[model samples]
Target: MDAPIRKHNATDEERFWAKVDKSGDCWTWTAAKTNGYGVFRIKPRNMVAHKVSYIWAHGPVPKGYEVDHMCFNRSCVNPAHLRLLTHQENGQNRTGANTNSKSGVRGVYWAQGQWIARACIGPKTILVGRFDDLGEAERAITEWRIEHMPVSLRDRRRRVSGPLADA
Candidate 1:
């Protein structure tokens, strides 16, 4: 196996996290996004820089894998918690209200003879509103996503080519 990300002499994970300033609401880093979700910048955005720094310091990324945010936080840079996963595996692990299921992404829970919408994310669970019907549940998800995760104008998809195709 290759050396751990900490082995790199130039960039150190511990040092990277120390440079982060979270006084602002979002953890924004100066690094450009490498391999899509992987952030890399000389300065720092929020806390994501640490994660990118760790990978950059190490070596080339392995095949068929993607770095995932274990904390489910886009801004968190805690190296100890950062993990690797396949693209498909990442989708399978979706919790809360992000899953594309008819049962509801997150808020709705079936109880007794009714469907209730309880928006729970991270460590907090908000009652938001309960839905008596499935249509109500779907409506809640649509509204929630619209208000929270609005579609980005810039495309975030990454294109990766196979090895040795330049023949």
Candidate 2:
């Protein structure tokens, strides 16, 4: 079944910002930029948080923790929906073009009895390693991403399809 539709609008971003309290404590402050990019806590990267939970649930500047926007909209600041996650757990929810570009284990082919890991780095797809199990392939890519991509930028790429794209 399809998920229920949440409220959405392209109205002025200023409308949301007015509801935040910029001078309050970290847990209670209005954590958003004036531009309505969503509530952002000032820091190295302007961490995005939901206004209700007063929790920033995305990007890596917070360090050692993972934030995920349950609403799925980067510009959405509904605190009730934000969730904290581990770096690994956050990676599991990723969906986008970068993840879809025939990369990682998604495009690999194994011989009848073999297990292999592969990904597209740019224009070419290459082998990551040969493993005995799918779990091992997952570990390889996880390690590769941790080593090569920045914490804040991990799985940051996103792709939207279907009716939503028409907007």
Candidate 3:
């Protein structure tokens, strides 16, 4: 492995920026990653690159809070694209649907021949609403998320595909 993100002579802030690629809208980490997230190893332990970036730009992450990629790019270390969120808020902005989801949308699933809309916050799953119409189920979940999640969810459209495309 290359030298840890911090080396003896260089300041932590200076050394950290050296490995970032800022050519695009999202600044990406150019080095090592773990589970799709960039890792920066220093003396004590390995710190997430985006977390380091957020600390440098903003401040320390509050107790019990996590750093989230507002742009949905896991490798992005751009401070502008990052925000602090509670674990529950972060869970709300999942990047994609689960493998079992046929609707191609998260939180909306089919059960018992009707559509179910639910939001999972950690271990608990809250039912938003249910509808015979798939679109109505989707809309119910989406609206519930927007109103309830602590962080702002991306307002972009979700692509509905597979069996749910027509509905």
The most accurate candidate by lDDT is 3
* Model 1 lDDT at residue 16: 55
lDDT (Cα, 0-100) at 105 in candidate 2: 47
Query: 85, model 1: CA deviation in Å?
Result: 0.4
For model 2, give the 10-residue run with minimal summed lDDT.
158-167
TM-score, model 2 to reference: 0.34
lDDT of each: 0.50, 0.48, 0.81
Q: Model 1 over residues 1-167: C-alpha lDDT tens digits?
A: 99445434565555555445455543434334453343544554433454464475554447887666655655555555456766655543454454554574455677777776664344566665666877676456445533443231111110013121221
Q: Which stretches of candidate 3 lie over 4 Å from their true place?
A: 1-8, 122-124, 150-152, 155-167
Q: On residues 81-143, what C-alpha lDDT tens digit does candidate 3 reach at each position?
A: 998888877877777679888987778888899898998777888988878988788767766
Q: Which of 1 and 2 is ahead in TM-score?
A: 1
Q: RMSD to native for every prediction?
A: 15.5, 13.6, 4.4
The candidates, ranked best first by TM-score, are 3, 1, 2
Clashing pairs in 3: none
* Candidate 3 RMSD computed on C-alpha atoms after optimal superposition onto the true structure: 4.4
